[model samples]
Target chain A: DAGVTQSPTHLIKTRGQHVTLRCSPISGHKSVSWYQQVLGQGPQFIFQYYEKEERGRGNFPDRFSARQFPNYSSELNVNALLLGDSALYLCASSSLFRDRVTGNEQFFGPGTRLTVL
Target chain B: ELKVEQNPLFLSMQEGKNYTIYCNYSTTSDRLYWYRQDPGKSLESLFVLLSNGAVKQEGRLMASLDTKARLSTLHITAAVHDLSATYFCAVDTPLVFGKGTRLSVIA
Candidate 1:
């Protein structure tokens, strides 16, 4: 009954370096989504994976990518990180894939705060 | 493309007072959600509004959605300091979020 969880609570990277953030969804959850939240702004969706398949993607640059494992865990990778990428990366899990009626409410993880220095 | 807009980017409320936050979206969507985030913290799901005229309430917070107007509102009744945080309303599944409304409650 543990909620969604993410690793490396804090990370500091250089402008050109790459970073990988991991997320473990709640048990029985098959959908995972990634989001980037800038300070003082709402989170922006990055990628969504359902049943270990790419379900949807946001308007983020090609530098941002993500994948889901068979166990419903997920990883978000950012390549050639820019100063603009310095934000909190969040992972959310939902029980259902598409139906909004129920179990589609995404519960979020603690998030990985990435700082590009 | 869906665009979400939230009003009063920042709000300062006195305890025991009442106020409302509004979210307006550009496109039609059946699903709308409200989330709360404290500083340096992740989002906490507050409400999931799925249909037109859907209203859900929890304690001092209430959320309602009007799909026809592409708008949703979060109302705070008798605000308390414990409720201070930034609130965001997102649209659709992929969730196009609006600029959040930061609420600060003062005693």
Candidate 2:
């Protein structure tokens, strides 16, 4: 079974430009989450979509948005990108069960490296 | 707001040595995860610890969680050069991560 996959291994954009990163979840996974990992820092959660609905969001600003498709693939878009937005964008997929007691193991992708010049 | 902290942001040890990484979170959460990442690579799941006193081990790495103290520990036993990487502990309140611990196992 293939793991979560992300596209455009590397991207270069300018300040005030817009960029979109895509992710395809593993088979049978229903939830997709986006994260931004700055160099030398841990990943920060941006958005989480479960069953095509926004389930959670992190401290990111409105410039960051994400949506999940019926097939559990997702796209993360950043508008008016700033120099601070340069980082590796990661995507993770998991099966969110109804019961909270179960531990959902998130599978991550080889994040897309975004650079704002 | 929840916050996660990892102690010893960096670790350097010779092969066959042992070390442990600590993770402390501000809020209560039962689900904790350990992930390893090589330079310029994505994260690889190491352990998923759920509930108080949950412990899991794989090869030379072991992870334990204490929900009461909101702490988790990743212990590396007899470390090898191949184990050199950054390790991160995350609390699954939808997943919040701590500053990773970069481990360099010298051979």
lDDT (tens digit, per residue) of candidate 1 on A44-79? 999999999999999899998899998999999999
lDDT of 1: 0.93
- List lDDT for all candidates, in order: 0.93, 0.93
Model 2, A1-117: lDDT tens digits are: 899999999999999999999999999989998999999999999999999999989989999999999898999999999999999999999888333655888889999999999
Off by over 4 Å in 1: none
Every candidate's DockQ is 0.77, 0.83
Docking class of 2: high
Name the lDDT of candidate 2: 0.93
TM-score, cand. 2 vs. native:
0.97
Native-referenced TM-scores of chain A, all candidate models: 0.97, 0.95
